[model samples]
Target: GNLNERKFLSTLVKENEVIVDMFAGIGYFSLPIAKHSKPKIIYSIELNLESFKFLTENIKINRLDNIIIPINGDSKTEVIKLSKSGVRAQLSFLVLY
Candidate 1:
């Protein structure tokens, strides 16, 4: 069931308990992780409004709005929010292109 998923993410984030999808493409990966792994938090970032819209819709479709945090902007900049909480989100897994 989680065979493929565990392989893909485990490689990059091997030890990263917390993961971040730098480029949340329609929530292809973010939604899955949030749905399966059920991590503490998933920050889905998308610069394009169209992409962001799709991501948001996907999150709703999967009912993961509570688990996945949709950031409608560049992940590089919006990542600051994770720190606003005083360093609670020390992400170890980062998904990029």
Candidate 2:
């Protein structure tokens, strides 16, 4: 299991913001990002279909149906829209675990 990094990251999350999980990996961090943070839009990208499916199911299982958006694609290509949309809006925090 991994430690919760988003608890601190959420301090930087704001309304009208975009977040990109450069490597979403089963939504380990993205799920919490939606639950404990502001209601900003999130874009989670996963390369593995199995993991992406679980990631979507995790969101549903957690009942976080409205906030975290899961995408099954490469982060490098998939995140362009999110980045252009404004994920880099604020680099206020960077918590890694």
Give per-residue CA lDDT, model 2, range 1-97, as digits (tens).
5454557666567766667765677777777777777756677788899999999999999988688788888767776766676566343222355
Which digits, one per residue and each the tens of the lDDT, describe model 1 over residues 11-37? 443233556677776877777667556
lDDT score of residue 41 within candidate 1: 70
Overall local distance difference test of candidate 2:
0.71
Instruction: Work out the TM-score per prediction.
Output: 0.72, 0.75
User: How far off is residue 74 in model 2, in Å?
Assistant: 0.8
Give lDDT: candidate 1, residue 61: 90
Best by TM-score: 2
Q: Which residue pairs in candidate 1 collide?
A: none
Clashing residue pairs in candidate 2 (N, C-alpha, C atoms within 3 angstroms): none
Ten contiguous residues minimizing lDDT sum, candidate 2: 88-97
Over the full model, what C-alpha lDDT does candidate 1 score relative to the true structure?
0.69
Q: Candidate 1 has what TM-score?
A: 0.72
